[model samples]
Target: MPQPMGQTGGWESYPLNPAVHPGKKVVFQYTAEMEVKTLVFTLIDKGHE
Candidate 1:
């Protein structure tokens, strides 16, 4: 499993399994005390194989 680098906000990139679906929706779960101010999900295209 890939762990989050830390609890700070910035740009992050992770290598995902190729089997993962492209249209899947990601969810972020946090405690009431900690708030998720922003979330940016991006998918880069390398062109068709």
Candidate 2:
């Protein structure tokens, strides 16, 4: 779920299953009252380098 951080929209985080295959497709759905300026997605690896 998306979380409201402040006036600048919000962020959401989901834990991917270890068995999830690469190149998997993801879909996001939302409604906004105003024109969305920007959308960013980031993936972080928490395992050891």
Determine the backbone clash count of candidate 2: 0
lDDT string for model 1 (26-49, tens) is 334333334554454544453532
Could you give the C-alpha RMSD of every candidate to the true structure, in order shown?
7.2, 6.0
* Alpha-carbon shift of residue 36 in model 2 (angstroms): 8.1
Model 2 regions more than 4 Å off: 1-4, 21-43, 46-49
Q: Extract clashing residue pairs from model 2.
A: none
Model 1 TM-score is: 0.27
lDDT of 1 at 36: 50
Which parts of model 1 have CA positions greater than 4 angstroms off?
Answer: 1-9, 22-36, 46-49
Instruction: Tell me the lDDT of model 1 at 7.
Output: 56
TM of each candidate vs. truth: 0.27, 0.33
